[model samples]
Target: MKQIVVIGGGPAGVEAAVAAAKGHSQVTLISEGPIGGRTGWDSLLPSKVWLHAAELAGVAEHTAEGVAIGAVHVTPTEVLNRIKQVAQRWSEREAQRLQAAGVKVVHGVAAFHSPHELIVRNDDSQQTLTADAVIIATGSVPRFPPTMKPDGQRIIAPRFASHLNTLPPDMIVIGGGPTGSEFASLFSRLGVKVTWIVGAPGVLPMFDPAAGAALAAAMTAHGATIHQVDVERAERTEGGVVVTTADGATHTAAMAFLAIGRVPDLSRLNLAAAGLEVGANGQLAVDNYGRTVAGHIFVVGDAAGGPMLANRALAQAWIAGRTAAELSAPGYCPHTVVSAVYTVPEIAQVGIVSGGEGELQRVRASYTASLKAYLSDETEGWVELIYDAVNRQIRGGIAVGTHAADMLAPVALAIQTGATIADLAAVFAAYPTLSEVVFAAARAVK
Candidate 1:
């Protein structure tokens, strides 16, 4: 049997280990904390839970149809407890499933003793294990600039912020990425004053410019103070934490959150000892198949340094795990993966956006045209489709609106299948639905 060692127990690690074990390989999954990864416990899932609550709170105030709510207030401690409970349940379930699949689960920090050897250390002791193949899915952690290092008291990172016992009266959120915006939105809805500082010209810069603007406008409507072109430098003061902009303007808040971005967590892995090249950011240099420079070693997830979504990590993990297992077995083809981001109004994309000159066919439709949006009073999003004009094949699609992540799945599948704009246009989506916007956009492509 081929012995495979999967490091890091996040989404990527769990998926990789599970998939590898299914291939009849002897797999060992190791994690420093309870399994299910950061997405399972900290970032993705917890954020969604909070967002769901926030959305409901919005609905309660706006009143969808005759549905009315009486005095809704969310306590920060209650939210934190729910997050912990869900995380614990998921971790336990994943542990049980792995054990049932005959995959060994190790609770420890794993370091490279050599290319094929791992030294696993926990609270008590250490053990050395050898594997024929090693997969690194160590994932990434939030990057806080040295000047703004979070003390975890008044100043914190997303991981710490998510589990706070009480909401601050005023919060300064640095970095206007998805996480930052989400934090700002959540807190603002919970009645906290939020100052959202975007180092870039606008928030959600990766999304379509229109989408970014709309999202920012929505957050602003909810009472968030948006500061563009602002770089925050954090400091502790007598009253509270003070964040100063590059222009020397200071803003004081009860708490500050650092959503600066993430860095690969591979520094301690000692990849050099394994003859693997790591990028300057500590990301492992991997091929399309997630193989490292060392033939037997592979890397996936955040450590691979592409899109850092949990779904993306899971997809890469599936590919790496199956490919590594196939090298030991025989036939397996990795599927094209889709990526999704769950911010308010969500953002999802698949395949590469065609930018270079070519016969390009594009279409866009507003969510306002959808009956569901009209009914739900959410008409501020849109769906965009892009196709090759020459071949008429779907190149990519992006959606920013309610259930956007779920709605984009079909487009992702179509792209993977080489479906054309006409092919998608012909498909019947349910009437008065958000998905119909996709169909409308596809049909508009010429």
Candidate 2:
């Protein structure tokens, strides 16, 4: 029986460990803290909980929209407690399941002693573990520019932002990525004066231009001041903090949260000692199968670069874990993965948007026509489908509206199975549901 060692304990690590432990392999999962990773504990789950509250608050504020809403209020302490409870429950449940499956769970910091050996340190003791294959699923950490160091009080990071017990008088969210926009939207909906700084010209630069514009407009209507410029520096001031732009203008706020993105957490591992090579951005270079430069050692999730979503990491981990096991088994193929971002109206996509011979013809439809959006009072988003003009097959799809994440599964399936636009349009979706928008969009592509 082969022994597999998985590091990190985040979404990718947990999924990889679970997948690798199946069948005859003896799997050992290691992490510095609890399982569930940063996404489950610090980012996605907590932010979504806050967003749920914000959505209810929006309904209350817009009572004229035909929905009778009572006085909505939130206690930050209660929200934090709920987040902690959910994270703890998930961690405990996953740990129990892995243990029952005969997987060894170790709480510690793991570093490679050699290509096949690891030294794990916990509390005051250290343990040496040897494995036939090692999967590096160690995730990334929130990044802060050298010019601005977070104090966790006035100037903060997302990890700290998730635990705040009180709303600030005024807040400035730096970085216009998905994280920044989500935080800005949540704070603004809670009636906090919010100034959202986007280094680029639009809110979600990675999304389609129209989608980004729609998001910016929605946030603006909800009382968020969007600033699209380079932020030079942030400093603690008399009452709060002052953020200076590259053009020399300064904005003051009671608190500032840095959403500047993240970098792979590989410094402590010392990959060179294990004959591994990192990419230009410091990520462990790996193919779709997660095989690193060392060949025997595999990397998955955020540490492997590309889209850093937790689900994406899990999908990649599934492929990596299976492929690693199949090195001794038979019949394995790598699978294409999908990625999603959870913001107001969510964002989801799958498959590559390629050009040339396999050029994709894009089909777009608005959620304004959906009865569910009308009844739910969430008509500010749309769905887009990309199809191969030659084969008429659905190549990719994106949605930004209520339950976009849930609706994206079908689109991802269609793309994975080479389903054409006509095929998707042929399927009947329940009327008055948000999912109907996808079929409608596919049908519009002619």
> Cα deviation of 422 in candidate 1 (Å)?
0.6
Assess every candidate by TM-score: 0.94, 0.93
Candidate 1 lDDT by residue in tens digits, 149-185: 8888898887774667877899998887778877777
TM-score of 2: 0.93
| lDDT: worst 10-residue window of model 1 | 327-336
Residue 342, candidate 1: alpha-carbon lDDT:
57
lDDT of 2 by residue, 45-92 (tens): 788788877776666776655557677888899888888888889888
lDDT of 1 at 110: 90
